[model samples]
Target: MAPSKTVAPANASAANVLSSVVNSYIDKTPQRTKLIDAFLGFLVLTGVLQFVYCVVAGNYPFNAFLAGFSATVGQFVLTVSLRMQSNTENKGAFEAVSPERAFADYIFGSLILHFFCINFIN
Candidate 1:
């Protein structure tokens, strides 16, 4: 008779390792990073909702769906860029650029993204 393979213990150990790693990370992360993480999570949820809507409603208005999805993705990208640029640890690398400039760039990029999304949606 062939031996039976037991995977439960391996799965449990993997889950435990992942949980500990996440817990450690959460404990060490700064409040600002936590807020940004929450924002990113919200954006992901919004994108998922848009995808579900498209699936349920049938992409009759394909342009609108494209515009919405692209906006979500663009915003997420811009937010991540802002977070990276504003991080204190990256000060040495971004010494020449100020946080205000990074924020201004983010705003400019967002405006450009919205402009394109609006045009494409029409």
Candidate 2:
């Protein structure tokens, strides 16, 4: 008789780790929330500034612009994802996603973004 076999689902560990980390952040101090919010505002400001500078600077070094833009966008995506994944009061599809998994997804997406940016720049 053939031996019984089983395969674990991919990302099971990721889901578990993500869940725990997100839960821990719940009920954090108001100061923590304020700090996070302030940081995000800074990111938005940076993006706007960079965009304006790019427009004035012209696309002469299109490659450099692309790389810098990609890195900024990656950071933006990561910050937003962290917020969505860590919100305890958030109910709906977002609640089901673990913070760790979201982070991993954010990281993977950033890598892909960078890959394209690198090619465009070079």
Candidate 3:
């Protein structure tokens, strides 16, 4: 008797498929986008570290924890917005807005976030 062979579907999802997709995406993505991704990742890591510290040492100063975490989160959000605004592909969507304007908005937002964080900390 001959052994039967099974064929996989063309669209079959494999364990390594995600890695391949991510690799391809990274390869094709612009350098600016990659930089933004790295920055966002750093912000997230900082926030995570702050949380871990608070947990380990106890949130003795809850306001300080909130200030640090909020600052990280706020920076991440503002940076993401800057990325979106500065993206060439998104230029059409933001036809009325310029890169300079986006940067200004980022600075303004950061100032506000910093003010609140400082107030909360105190």
Candidate 4:
């Protein structure tokens, strides 16, 4: 009789290990947290720079450009707000705002952007 072969699931174990590593690092290091903050800030700045570049380029549909830009920027700002509230080191002034509310704000801003876009597109 031949012996049966056995395969082990690796992804679950890897995820568990990764989660533990992240949790331990966050618990232990302030530097990691600050680096994360700086990276996010840089992302926001890059977004703003792109928007400025779009403005300087002068596309045919300014409204459409603005609509897309607003949506992107609004979502970014909303997420940043969420992180601010969730982060242990910094207590955001708008900490009371929940994810749902921030999401709603993003959606509302998107709607307003599109509203202006359609009229301006024509």
Candidate 5:
């Protein structure tokens, strides 16, 4: 008869490490960082939806589609930068830039991006 096989030890070890990392993240991550992550998720969803719409229906006004999609992508990038700069773990790297400054930069960059996107759409 063939020998019975059991779960691999390596697979079990990998699962344990993954579980611990996830638990640590849930317990240690700050609320503000969570909020940024939520926004990033929203941006990704929005961009995906817009692309789907363009694909299913024809992009009659291709310029408008371009503007909307670009805005989502640009905003996502800006938000990620803000999150990185504001994170406590990265404080040493961004010593001179305070969280407030990073947020202000994000807002300013978003406004500029929107303005250009709108102009392109029209």
Candidate 6:
């Protein structure tokens, strides 16, 4: 007869690993990074809700829905790019670009994106 292997120890090990990872992220990540992450989360939620509304409501005003969804996706992409450039870990990758410069770029890009989105809606 094969000996039975208990699942409890394995489950506990997995839980421990996950807990440690979360703790590390919370402790080591900078406040600015956390703020950016929060904005990213908001964008993701907005996009998901827009998609669900489009699907359920049939997008009668399809252009408006498209513009809103596009803006969310574009903003998310820009924010991620900014986060990557400004992150301490990526300092070497963006050696010449300071965090302030990265933020300026993000704002400029966002303005352009919104302009086009608004034009599309109109």
Worst 10 residues of 5 by lDDT: 4-13
Q: How close to the true structure is residue 119 of candidate 3, measured as C-alpha lDDT?
A: 96
Q: Candidate 3 — which residues are off by over 4 angstroms?
A: 1-16
| Candidate 6 steric clashes | 0
Q: How many collisions per candidate? A: 0, 2, 0, 0, 0, 0
Candidate 1 stretches greater than 4 Å from native:
1-9
Off by over 4 Å in 4: 1-39, 42-46, 90-122
The estimated TM-scores of all candidates read 0.79, 0.56, 0.81, 0.39, 0.87, 0.92
Q: What would the per-residue lDDT of candidate 1 be over residues 63-104, giving only the tens digit for each residue? A: 999999999999999999988988888899899889899989
Ranking of predictions according to TM-score:
6, 5, 3, 1, 2, 4
Summarize candidate 5's per-residue lDDT along 1-122 as a digit string, tens digits.
99998767998989999999989988999999999999999999999999999999989999999999999999999999999999999999999999989999999999999999999999
Shift in Å, residue 48, candidate 4: 3.0
Give the C-alpha miss distance for residue 34 in model 6, angstroms.
0.3
RMSD of each: 4.5, 15.4, 3.5, 12.8, 3.4, 2.4
Which candidate, 5 or 6, would have the higher TM-score against the true structure?
Answer: 6
> Which lDDT tens digits does candidate 6 get at residues 28-121?
9999999999999999999999999899989999999999999999999999999999899998999999999999999999999999999999
**Model 5 residue 37 CA deviation in Å:** 0.3
lDDT value, residue 109 of candidate 6: 100
Which is superior by lDDT, 4 or 6?
6
Taking the tens digit of each residue's C-alpha lDDT, what string does model 4 give over 12-79? 88988999998987787566456656756776886787688786887676766766666556656655
Residue 100 in candidate 4 has what lDDT? 60
Report how far off residue 8 is in candidate 1 (Å).
12
What order do you get sorting by lDDT, best first?
6, 5, 1, 3, 2, 4
- For lDDT, candidate 4 versus 5, the one ahead is 5
Per-candidate Cα lDDT values, in order, are 0.92, 0.74, 0.91, 0.66, 0.96, 0.97
Query: lDDT per residue, candidate 2, 1-122, as tens digits?
Result: 99988866769978988888777656553554556667788888888888898899787887787788777777777777666666655647686687577768877886787777778777
The pairs that clash in candidate 6 are none
